[model samples]
Target: MLSEVTATRYVTPLREGGSLPGIVEADDLGTYVMKFTGAGQGRKTLVAEVICGELGRRLGLRVPELVTMQLDPVIGLSEPDQEVQELLKASGGLNLGMDYLPGSLGFDAKAYQVSSAEAGRVVWFDALINNVDRSWRNPNLLVWGGELWLIDHGATMIWHHNWPTAQVSAAKAYNASDHALAPFGPDIASAAAALAPLVTEELLTEVAAEVPDEWLVDEPGYATTDELRRAYVEPLLARAATIHERITLDAPAEDKPSQAPGWLSERLAPRPRATKNDKDGGQ
Candidate 1:
């Protein structure tokens, strides 16, 4: 879908993003936040976003629309002079874009002042997906148009490799008492139920088709496009309910006050029996 474009213009870089996302203008004149695979992290990151973000949207979470764009290498790297081009070249040869949320400020839980019920739903969803990006220090929530918007899904489903055999504790550290854990259990269960039926072969093929070949060309592990689709996209959709139920059952209770109001730790706390080396890999 992104290949139909002829050109794109790179704008400014988003300083807050760890991956150095850039703001860019697409051929249609829409602005998006684009993350690059410059150093080889692009394919995985972009694939994760497409699969998970789409699934999240289906589950009724507020995620911005994601689309792939063919970066005009020259436009992205172009600067006032050749000096700027060299600088851009060293950064990355292509760019990605996220739909821009105008006039939005970085999310602060206190700003939304969401009820504990709302917070619970957010917590449950994060836990279900094993999202490790929304901790107190780096709560990647945004407030635009008077609502909460979740962003940066690069850290979800990190345990997809052994998901069938993996323990819940291996994925996230959810407990019943965590304030962000309870409100959404019922809703999450319902959402998962609805999502399960939608993960059909056609849907899987269609969405996987949306992923750019440039992103997957060299990833040996995903040898074929079908393998890539099944490995990365289909499971999440097919097992939506199972995964949802598992996370809801294991999610921390909502009795404890949120340590930082709007933020919840994306990483589970370490177990006493965990080896020193087992510390917080998901975070």
Candidate 2:
């Protein structure tokens, strides 16, 4: 289970996203980015965030640590933003909090060249979860401490929105043509070989079981939260088995020709070590 904490104050909303996630100060004296249950996407979005974000963490990818935050509706009284006030009041109890990474710059492929291994690993992870939001325009990736971090997994597992028709085949073909690092030609085969074996039934079961019971309640066709947890795991385990083949079969041609690669090779070719100032890329 994730660490549980009490949210002591509601700071300000991060308006960059549709769900209106906000920066919150908690009793633990740590700042967190809280994803509200009352947002338009609803509790279901938070469900995906926990499952996929934690799964990625266990798979050795960089993701912000997640915690179960206890929110009090009374805090709404002090908020001037009516929209935020209503969201807080509605999401009175348990919500999801991702540890806030301060001074992190949004990932820009042009600004920083990602190695093939890193790109491949990320692409592989995204494909397994059926995430469709890593396009070049809105990468949903952050760079902190000169390392990449994945975030905003609420958009993954869209099939869960309609439980009746959802199938293991939810792991459909992924079109990576517009992905932020598509030009790098990720080593999907190598990544799949290393990561696929790690996605065992036990791992998915543990990850799915971590969702707060409050968020899992009232889910249609399930009488208990345990059943809902199983529903989340089954499709994901099925996808893990076939992700590599699906992506390799569906991947389109790259922008640059096969012979000459662009920015990545030039940036990676042996040269003087990058200075700390250079790492910021002038954010």
Candidate 3:
């Protein structure tokens, strides 16, 4: 369990985040981004942050540390001054703090032009988990300490609910022509081979264990932590090698700018786009 801290100081909101994460100094002298889970999307986002973020770390990817936080209600729903209160109300629960990446830039594939092998590994991992967040426009990658760190996995495994029938197939089929597509080949194959063994039932169970019970309760499709783990986490780990092989062989090698889809990119981007009516000269 994460420790509780009194909210004495307020950290500024991050311009890019949807949940409006704030920077705060914990009682333990650690700095973190306090993220409030607002209405509608609060619990799910937290679960994704914890489960996927932890799993990625286990798989040897760099992800920021996360901790549970409590926002002071007295602040009560204001921006800049009452920002913490507003965050608490919007999130529907207490606030969460993400470990801030000091002086780190968001992920830019162009910055990393690594070997096809490394790209292949990243692609395979993304594909295996059906990660739709890492796209051309808003690649949720960060550069810190001269390495690429993956972030914001709240959108992965959506296909599970969105496309229930879809399953890992022997046929490797994914759109690899995107500019951000990882270079695929034997290097990816070798990397997959090395990483395949790391994905196991125990690993999945451990990852699932980290998910809060609030996320697992009263859901018809996914009831109980173990069931959710079996349904979602287990399949990906089981098919890790196959999925990796498929993504490596099937994806195209191209260099493209990071741009997410229309709605998604709008949410993830540092700046919002003008509405169509605004563009059309509406008052």
Candidate 4:
């Protein structure tokens, strides 16, 4: 399991995220962003966060360090917001904590550009996880210390919500046309070449072990938490075997800046080179 720490204080909620995660100070003298197990999305959200976030870190993508935070209900007593207090009370046990990076900025595709290699790896990973939240409208990427970091993985692994058909769901083609990185020219083949071989059974087992046992208990079909952990591993490994081949960026040619719909063409238009005659005339 990831390092476990106890929350000492809840500072404020991050209004931007759908789950209303908050900034917290932990007893270890570190600050973290807390994802509550009691969010409307349920413990399944945190489960995805741990599984996907840890997997990305292992795959050499930048993801914040994670921990299993011990949240005490009493920490909410000082908060005036009734909703926040209720949520804290309900999430009194284990929750998810991401190491807080101070002064980080949200990703802006317009202002910044990532290399095709980086874009491909991220898009490929998102496809395998079935994350639909990385669209241009709400890119869940962060720029901290000049490198991109992935966060907000709660929306991935939708099949877990319907356990009976998870296998079938895992085989479907991913829709990444609107992915924020789509316009950046993702090199999916290279991503598969580099990361696919690393997703071994041993790696999956280690990743699954990081999920807290409490979240795995009483899952509808599983008799024990270990059984549930194995369930998480099977679908992902199966998806990884075939998903890379099916991930066609699918973004139209016009989406690329050089061929964009209207003004983009003008912005990318090539300027004529100055001739020798023109240079001599100026001289």
- Which candidate's TM-score is highest? 4
Q: How accurate is candidate 4 locally (lDDT)?
A: 0.87
TM-score of each: 0.68, 0.87, 0.73, 0.90
Q: Report backbone clashes per prediction.
A: 12, 0, 17, 0
Output the better candidate (3/4) by lDDT.
4
Tens digit per residue, CA lDDT, model 3, 23-127: 777666778877666634556666667767777788887778767766665445444455555555555445566777888887654445445566666666667
- Runs of candidate 3 with Cα error greater than 4 angstroms are 1-8, 76-85, 92-95, 110-112, 160-173, 179-186, 248-283
Candidate lDDT scores, in order, read 0.58, 0.86, 0.61, 0.87
Candidate 2 lands at a TM-score of 0.87
Candidate 4 residues lying further than 4 Å off, grouped into runs, are 251-283
Per-residue lDDT of candidate 2, residues 244-279 (tens digit): 788742234456321112444555568988887789
Question: Between prediction 1 and prediction 3, which has the larger lDDT?
Answer: 3
Best by lDDT: 4
lDDT of 1 by residue, 1-283 (tens): 5433323676676767766677778787788877666623445777667666665675567888876666545674445555334434644444445688999887654444565545555665676556777764577778888887878887776754444543443434543333232322235544445555665666656656666666656555557666666665544443444555554233343553344322243223344686556677645
Indicate the residue-level lDDT of 89 in model 2: 87
